[model samples]
Target: MQTFHLDAISQDRQTLAEPYHEFLRTRDMSAGVYHMEPGSHDPQGAHQEDVLFYVIRGAATLRVGDDELEVGAGSIVHVPARVAPRFVAVAEAIDVLVVFAPAESAPTIEVKYTA
Candidate 1:
């Protein structure tokens, strides 16, 4: 049996797409707890896998497609494969849990940003 302790993970400010924090990914599943500070926005990049975001603390504005929703503690957001979606922490601090299947096995679309 394998277990991951949140405290055991280093608070390394790793950048994924745009947001930065301690992100832990496994071989079968990718999951992480994000800490988004006020006035900070995490860049949205489309992935080839289905993803879900669970707000564990604070609040944020979720942009899924053309609709915007306010998400806070106990709120969960799901992003389907090939769907382009993004989110930003709107409150002072937002803590969220992101879950997704391994990229190699999941069907995903890449969202590239160009200037």
Candidate 2:
């Protein structure tokens, strides 16, 4: 039984960008906590593996393909592999638990975001 706590993950002070403290990452999946301050947003990028973004606190907007949707606390957004989706932290210092799986085996795709 593997057990862990988010408190054990310390706040990142090295950079000005949103803090990302990786807890665990195996050959099959990866997990981490992302903290973004108010008006701050993470880059809209694409990856190869399928991803699930779970909102732990606050609200955000998710862009999947040509569609844009709003998500908040307790909300989960599942993104399919090979698809480029972007997530923006809209509310004050949103915290998100992101998980990526399949060990990044899929092919990468281009993602474009518009305001």
Candidate 3:
């Protein structure tokens, strides 16, 4: 069985322009870590596959379509395929574990940056 340690995964210094680190990928699904700084937000978009986000550290206000809620470390958020999702009002730097089923290819729609 394949094994991964979170500490080891976090130690990798690879910087992404999009604030994400893809740590695992398989035929069935893919997993990655996303980091966002305070006051920063994710671009609004939708994925082709169902996606799951597990907050690993910090907190933020997450918006899924017309709904919005506060999410903190240990919270899990799910976004169905082709549903718009975004994060905002970050109180602190946030680290989230992201997973996509059936492996994500690309966004179903064009991404829009949020200010």
Candidate 4:
């Protein structure tokens, strides 16, 4: 068994991509922490795995498909496979916990993302 701490991980995270720190990877899933500056854009694209985003801090508007939602600390959002999500109008820097079930694979479609 293994244990992880958020603050320590956040400070020392080895970023595989800008703003996205992939902390754990397993056969069944992967996990990461995504942090954005107040006006920064999210550069991730759609993934082959279904994903969940848990808002740990900050505020922003989350868009999935044609729908948009206001999200802040403690907000949880889900996106299905092949769908792109984005966070717009970021009112503050945000940290989001991202999880992908069955891990992530190369996208078969166009690219874009949120957290």
Please, what are the lDDT tens digits per residue for candidate 1 over residues 1-115? 6576655432443334435343556676677676777887666566677778888788778877666899989998888766666775477577777787663243345565444
Candidate 4 residues lying further than 4 Å off, grouped into runs, are: 14-17, 106-108, 111-115
Candidate 3, which segments miss by more than 4 Å at Cα?
13-18, 111-115
CA lDDT of each candidate?
0.67, 0.72, 0.83, 0.83
| Candidate 1 TM-score, C-alpha based | 0.71
Span of 10 residues, lowest total lDDT, candidate 3:
9-18
Question: Which runs of model 2 end up more than 4 angstroms from their true locations?
Answer: 10-18, 104-109, 112-115
Please, what are the lDDT tens digits per residue for candidate 3 over residues 56-89?
A: 9999999886679899999999998877878968
Put down candidate 4 lDDT per residue, 15-42, tens digits, no spaces.
Answer: 3446877788999998989888788877
Q: Decide which is better by lDDT, 2 or 4.
A: 4
The window of 10 residues in a row where model 4 has the poorest summed lDDT is 106-115
| Candidate 4 lDDT (Cα, 0 to 1) | 0.83
Clashing residue pairs, backbone N/CA/C < 3 A, model 1: 48-107, 48-108, 48-109
Q: Comparing candidate 1 with candidate 3, which one achieves the higher lDDT?
A: 3
Clashes (candidate 3) = 0
lDDT by residue for model 2 (26-115), tens: 898987777777777566467788888888887777777777898889989898876677665476567888888965443456765576
Error of 3 at 105 (Å): 0.4
